[model samples]
Target: MTKLQAEVRSNSVAKGKDAMVTEDELDNLAYLKAVVKETLRLHMPAPLLVPHLSMADCDIEGYTIPSGTRTIINAWALARDPSYWENAEEFMPERFMDGGSAAAIDYKGSDFLLLPFGTGRRICPGITFAISTIEIMLANLVYLFNWELPVELAEKGIDMTESFGVTVHRAEKLLLVPIVPQD
Candidate 1:
């Protein structure tokens, strides 16, 4: 949280303390972007990407997949695959930073390991808008105030469980107390 606050506060000096994060400044907020990527990696909006149909008979590994077979891509599993990610289950935003191991991987679909927004010709059309919205909202939140974890969670810890549906949701509600940061 301090890292995010520092990143936002450092960039917001010229914009004024009251000014919300702007779209133009998103490019310079590297850590903010990494946080968003890490968030998506841990809790994806959709666990399974849109299903695909095989165009022709093909063999993957040892199994033969016939044409017209409906195949679902488990994007959540791919993002959390240990072989492709170090400490795969851990929430480490730095993994997507400039020199991090997964730096080259992204949700834009170019990288298969981290395809939170799906990939190929059928990739999400709202991807650009979605990422920008996430970046701006997250940047502003960290820039505007300080957040405190609930007292109950401090002792019990946060519940990372999820309830599956059209979109994934936290099984337990997280109540964060936002304290306006002082000058």
Candidate 2:
């Protein structure tokens, strides 16, 4: 969580916002939201969405999907689709904000373009809890501290590499330097 906060702060600064993040500022931080969305997209904790069994035969995208077919949604692939994102291979959060109204798109099941937490009935049961926790924690941390990459690692840019499992995690552990805010 601390690492994530650091990354968010770094991103905010890169976009020319001051290093500090406040509660009121959260609503206007479209770039931060975009960063979060891009992070979730590129590193989906669950690379494969929950499995489901089709009740009846169905054809989707011209494929003959038979009844009782067990299927899994490849959320990882969907998130990286070039049709939905430009420079899909790059970790560019600005793409989400380049268009009008970055916040117009919904992260819920409504938007097919981005589904880090899956979609429809099988969507993550903990969606609300996860989102609320992240927002509150990020707000408080940014409100309280200024962060930097550790001296030893500062020369090396953030390693965005991933190691996949039940949940995705950084290939290498994240180490950061934190400074408490002065009143």
Candidate 3:
């Protein structure tokens, strides 16, 4: 967490004091982008993408798919597959950074192994907007404030148990104390 804070702060300093963090600055936030990518990989906004119908007969890894079959793509499983990710279950953003094992992967749908957004012609139209919004919001949060676990949670650590739904969320709501960083 401290490392992530450092990354955001380091980039934020270049904007000078009192300048609003904007989308234009996102390009400089490589680590933040990697963190967002890793988060999407681990906890996809929609774990089960909308069902895609097979337009024609197709063979995938020897399995014959008859035309018109509704196929559900499990994005969560794809991200956890050891074949595609190193330390797949761990929350490590470095994997998406340059020179990391899965550096080339992206949520843009071209990469089958990390499709946070569904692929091909049916890919989500809001993908670019969503990614940009998240990155900017996250960058601002890290740049403007220092966050810490609530005192009650400091000793016990975070409970990451997730509750399944249309989308997944932590079973226990996260509690944080955000203090504006003093210069």
Q: If scored against the real structure, what TM-score would every candidate get?
A: 0.92, 0.75, 0.92
The full ranking of all candidates by lDDT, starting with the best, is 1, 3, 2
Query: For residues 1-183, what per-residue lDDT tens digits would candidate 2 score against the true structure?
Result: 445455455444343335445445466556556666777778878878778899899988999999999998787887788887677778776667757433455578687767788888877888867765676566656645677888878888789788877677789987777788554
Candidate 3: the clashing residue pairs are none
Q: What does the lDDT come to for candidate 1?
A: 0.88
Stretches > 4 Å off in candidate 3: 13-19
- Give the lowest summed-lDDT range of ten residues in model 1: 12-21
Over 4 Å off in model 2, which ranges? 1-28, 97-103, 181-183
Stronger candidate by TM-score (1 vs 2): 1
Task: Provide the lDDT at 106 for model 3.
Answer: 77
lDDT of each residue in 1-183, candidate 1, tens digit only: 999999988877465656887888889999999999999998998989778999999999999999999999998999899998899999899999989988888767888888888898889999889999889888988888899888867777778789988689999888888999778
What value does the lDDT take at residue 84 in candidate 2? Answer: 70
- TM-score of model number 3: 0.92
Candidates in order have lDDT scores of 0.88, 0.69, 0.86
